[model samples]
Target: MVAFLDEGGMVDFTIEYELTPDEVGRALHRGLKLQLRAVRLAVPTILAVSGITCLLVDAIGLGVGMLAGAVLFPFVLAWSARRLAKRQLTYLCVPTTLRFTDDGYEYRTDQSATTMRWPLFGRVVSTPEFWLLFVGKQCSAFLPRRAFTSEQQAELDGFFAARQKAGAL
Candidate 1:
């Protein structure tokens, strides 16, 4: 998968990348499980904290209610947001192909293919939503979980581990 920009920031190439069904299925399962866990953990904590705060604060019982509501609202919204984000991240429909070559990996997006060597990546991180390959503090690649399989996920883990070993990302 190579996604790049020209001097003018115009997209050069983009495509619906491919991945095996098994890989996509595994990634989706993992992403779903993680998001569910997050929702469960957050919901109880929000309720517990708010309940305590409301009981302890005589002047701001309303504040506690509002705080809890605010948190819970997002949890509700996250149900859909997580679903969409997971689909994009996991590449369930179309996986972005990334080729690891000597110069670095090439990733093709909808409009362009960009190449970045390992040395250019300053850090790498993963969440239930994305596999982030950072170029620096402000620049990065956001690969969705929906776009990869279990094997690919393992491959990415190894890639990042190698980067850490080399003191790159």
Candidate 2:
């Protein structure tokens, strides 16, 4: 299944929805809240890890070890935080049109569309950025607000609610 969100018939602050069979790949997208949390966690984790490493190295009389850890810790932490944030955006924040079918849902973004089957759906979680349909431990497809208009969002939300009730999700 496939879905398309066109811009031609767009209304002010309105979103459009359509379904198609072709699959497009997903993109990098992350929620502001999740990104912030990840960043917040990174600082403490980095400091702790670096502090421990520095102390251990100092006790061992390895002066370079402390210097290395101090220098590398912040860089590694920043990189990790950035990477995780990017992953969240790619797997959970990017905009896409989702089409539901017997197999799974087809998520279409500007770059590509990808199929996310039911078995891959560990759970469905929602955030302001998107409705995350988790496929694996950390894999997900992001359905952004841009995918639907305010009215359409309500309709789609109702549709998913019904599906959940019927155990069709």
Best by lDDT: 1
lDDT tens digits, residue span 1-169, model 2: 2243446542122233432211112222333233345555665566556667766766544445554655675567556646655544444444545665445666666867776666566555565545766544353455655465566666556655665667666
Which stretches of model 2 miss by more than 4 angstroms? Answer: 1-98, 101-103, 108-113, 158-169
Candidate 1 residue lDDT tens string, 9-57: 4323333456555544444444444445666567667766776777677
Q: How much does candidate 1 score in TM-score?
A: 0.45
Q: lDDT of each structure?
A: 0.58, 0.51
Q: For model 2, state the Cα shift of residue 105 in Å.
A: 2.2
Q: What is the lDDT of residue 19 in candidate 2?
A: 23
For each candidate, give its TM-score against the true structure: 0.45, 0.46
At residue 98, give the lDDT of candidate 1.
61
